[model samples]
Target chain A: MAKQQVISPLPGTFYRKSAPDQPSYKEEGDQVAVGETIGLVEVMKSFHEIKSDFAGTVTKFLIDNEDAVMAGQALVEIDG
Target chain B: MAINVISPGLATSVQDLGRPGYYHLGIPISGGMDRYALRAANMLAGNDEAAAVLEAVFMGPELAFTQDATVAVTGADLPPKLDGEARESWTSFAVKAGQVLSFDYLKGGARAYIAVSGGIDVPLALGSRSTYTLGALGGLDGRNLLAGDVLPLGAGTAAAEGRSVPAKLRRLPGAQAELRAMPGLYWHRITEASGRRFFEDTWKVALEADRIGYRFRDGRPLEFVERTPPFGAGSDPSNIVDSCYPYGSIQVPGGTEPIVLHRDAVSGGGYFMVGTVISADMDFIGQLQPHTPTKFVSVDMAAALAARHDRQAMLNEIRAMLA
Candidate 1:
């Protein structure tokens, strides 16, 4: 099995979708590539785009939208 | 190789370069407090500068290496030893398998960095391996090192050769390290006397200091200009607008004392940020022990840039020498 790499660039609440009512950018088993925008992290009223650093399939979403996360918390896992 | 911990010293945790770009989401950059020393140790071990390292505070753990490994210790000198013999710092050395490493009480400074060849093998979380203890994230199970923990080393097995300890570690000059003042959102709201005292006086680190924040013992109480209604739901007049705050911001609340936030500080805060310690001087701040007298010096934007450039040049020179 290939190693799955998880990347989270910022410290904030991980939001899976653009808005509360929308679906997530990815689901389990979704194919994702490096530099692909995976989700948004909202910090202090500013929204930042979290991008995938590895080309792989999304194996898991470790955090739910609106969940508070510290710096370096894994938000998603990518099977590289 | 593996290292077993006998006594997990005070507040020991795994750290790297820290997590950035998440302030807007209310996550502060949590990483090694003394970043320069950490980087130097990593470089000595021929590891990536951001590789995971053990951050030991005050006292350190008694570690037993399971295999031969190259290691470097940096930052605060806690009287570390290998197999009961004194160990040198800021230079890499070979540790025989099964040799015991331990640290005594800190004589100077607050924390130390232990970097193994390659790096510590903690799974990278949020692009870093630093532990944010308050949030319960990163490091080994998102907490301080405990007894019986075994940390794995990274894949590389290259041993360090010709260890050379420098006579003195470079530091930011105290005269040039007056804290810098940017006009924060609520900077103008304080009284003129309070503002003057903020620049003129030296503060003492209170016993309440920790990774979360360093509270200072200022002489006089700080009074707000006026109390206004809550800005938003759950917002109070004491709260300032949430914005990006760099490391070393000295935030003053309703109390007289100021709190100097460190690596594990929260992303955004509501208190008044009176001044920010320049990045060049931050490492020095990390070396401060409890009750240490800290004088906040003011640095203008131009001076801050010059200091940064000067430090970068020093780093480049060190790299060149190593090459």
Candidate 2:
């Protein structure tokens, strides 16, 4: 099995859930499916979904919730 | 015919060139932040240069077409998609009724313009369809687009598809940018060194930057010449007896951060305006992203007017090419 990391497509603030009160979209060791949004990256006050392109078990997130991130920064890891 | 809003991306609103004549009446000429890109998208969609279009900030709205129409996406590259399939930007594409148009993450630039063949059929306010969100005037009910809002479309012809702008001609937004400005007005009120340093320092775009004004991160505090406060002027050296603020006016309050008033800025203020961003460079200012390192370059009036002429010529060239 190969491990892949989901990377931020743009630079902005990263949030694990859709809203502050919302639970995490996916948890560690959870089975993730393709096209599933695991988090959101906000830029210019606009929220953009960070979708998982690979289906796998969630290993862990590389960044914390609400952290400022850069483009190409690894956001989450997955074991496929 | 109309387009149904599925999800209104952060602050999606209808905007055209703007309302200019009513500024003295306390109205801001709120319009497309990046007029060049707005016109580009409009021309590609075969609409008039000043046709109302959706100004989508970094993110774009998910719109469902109720009728077949042609559209062009310009300005910030939100990575537009039609029916989940990637569509080319800075160009026109026809979408059939029921096809959903959305966007991927922003690749570059700060805003995106979506111009449909027939413009958004909002009634004009003061001769322009531009939205002034501060006053809640114009656009669709004078505010940002909301989910479920059905926008009526005007009747117009569309150009052929695949009308792509040359990459060189497109905007290049980056972590660093330089904008040209013409100094004067209340500039002499500032210490000579501070005025010189203003142009030399690289200021970061503050997070609060918006259509009304862009406040840059203060790298060095500016110093103003001491003078007796005029009758209505506040005690601060930066305060002037209230005066009219020109578009792109750069004013400083508290002698620190410089705020460059933009297209939607208020008509007048009590602050000392040190310089004005050249008309041609205003579009570049609109494309600046937050935290970007920005610089101000001082230019003479001759150069400023020359740049304006060059921009006008470029618009003409674009119109002829698109035709």
Which candidate gets the maximum TM-score versus the true structure? 2
Residue B40 error for model 2, in Å? 0.9
List candidate 1 segments past 4 Å from native: A1-80, B172-183, B227-238, B241-244
Clashing pairs in 2: none
Here, model 2's chain A TM-score works out at: 0.97
**What is the C-alpha local distance difference test score of each model?**
0.73, 0.88
User: What are the per-residue Cα lDDT tens digits for candidate 2 across B1-323?
Assistant: 89999999777889999998989999998999999999999999999999999998766899999898999999987788999999999989998899999998777777899999999999988899988888989998889999999999999986788987777778666768988999989998999999999999999887668898988975688888989898999899999999999999999888788889998898997999988999999998887767788999999999999999988888787888897
Listed in order, the DockQ scores are: 0.01, 0.22
- Compared with the true structure, the alpha-carbon lDDT of candidate 1 equals 0.73
Worst 10 residues of 1 chain B by lDDT: B170-179
Q: Could you tell me the TM-score of candidate 1?
A: 0.74
Model 2 stretches astray by more than 4 angstroms? A1-80
Distance from true location, Cα of B305 in model 2, Å: 1.2
Q: Which candidate wins on DockQ? A: 2
RMSD, model 1, all Cα superposed?
16.9
Give the B-chain TM-score of model 1. 0.91
- The recovered share of true contacts, given per candidate in order, is 0.00, 0.12
Writing each residue's lDDT as its tens digit, candidate 1 over A1-80 gives 57565655334467889887888888989999988888886642357788888888898888887775533467888888
